[model samples]
Target: MGSINKTDLCWGDNYNLTEWYCNASNSIASKTYNCPYGCPYFAYACKKQNDVCVDSDGGKNWNVKGSITFANSTRTDHCSEISTGPVLVEYYCDDYGRIMEAYNTNCACNEGKCTDYFPICVDSDGGIDYFTGGQVTTSTSTIKDFCGNQLYNYTYESYCDDFGNANYKTYSCPNGPCSLVNGSGQCPSTTSTTGNVIYDLFKKVKIAGKVIQGIIS
Candidate 1:
């Protein structure tokens, strides 16, 4: 008689056929119910149990824990989402995919442009001027005293900054009327007595006429 193999099992064995058959069939069956190639039930009950677990706890996948209020909307448990405010909020994802926050105050206040402040010169007589280079001068004429008899010329050196603020230094004429020539005070070479007399007479006539008009009024 032929000898029976020790490993051979009879058809009436008590062990579950599906479990034993599937496990013994392929290495893939140990980790999953799905059998590998060559198994009769290869893809049987293989609907991916891990996928169901992942879908059930979908909110856990979001790294941020709180509800985020965006400028226009609200979101909960979403990664890589952006939000804005009146001031800029610079956000970036870290190497570990975590959202980080930073404030960007360097916003475009004046349309992303910059300008410089300028200096200006203002005279004591309330005249405004600017400083260019050598000896800038501003002048104004007023009646000597309130009598309106003689007109006096006032001269000032104009100095200014980028901001239009004015500063002035009084200029006194030594020999004649104050004049600015090439950014410097120039005195007349010869003083005319005749010219002065004529000017005085004309001023007296003008003042007398004004006084008469006021009296009539």
Candidate 2:
């Protein structure tokens, strides 16, 4: 069991719709459902017959209450079955079924397949970029000609959990501008100073441009 919030309170069973409800983990330490109102997150039914019940909103095996009669025929089940909102969250899972990254709808803006899987961004010049956790992990650059040789290469970087396991990153090279790629990879071989992430990406791009420009000149 997990934890319960104000949404989990209910006076009826699964069949009889009641107030919003959620469940916790088996240990019952904290409420796993942290979604706010109007946010598109997961939900479960609270089906305890007793007067007051705390439901498990995060764990599996949630029960949905059907038609119910309260005391006598004079009373009616006015509670309505709760419906989930639009898909606003995206999750990337590994082969072992573990979540790697999650993107919010407003941020990722990917519909349908992208709403559930990872996001892939390609620039006008065919440069690609991949990201998770609001950070770039992989990038591929546009193709370009240098010294009569078609230069092409890609850069790759990834994030690591506390246990030092690579999770997400990108890759790109020689072609032109870099683009993003999805999936886990080695930690970025390069490190930078503390700065806004976007700024850091711009700085790296500028440095790469300088190097390429010097070679081409």
Best by lDDT: 1
Q: Rate the local accuracy (lDDT) of all candidates.
A: 0.28, 0.26
What TM-score, to 2 decimals, does candidate 2 have?
A: 0.16
Give per-residue CA lDDT, model 1, range 1-217, as digits (tens). Answer: 5543222121211111233233455332323132221111111222222212111122222222333222222333322323431333333333322223433332321221112211223333233221112332223321111111113332343444344443333322334464544544333334431222112211232343443222110
Pairing residues by index, what is the TM-score of model 1? 0.18
Candidate 2 structure lDDT = 0.26
Worst 10 residues of 2 by lDDT: 68-77
Best by TM-score: 1
Q: Could you tell me how far off, in angstroms, the CA of residue 176 lies in candidate 1 after the best superposition?
A: 2.3
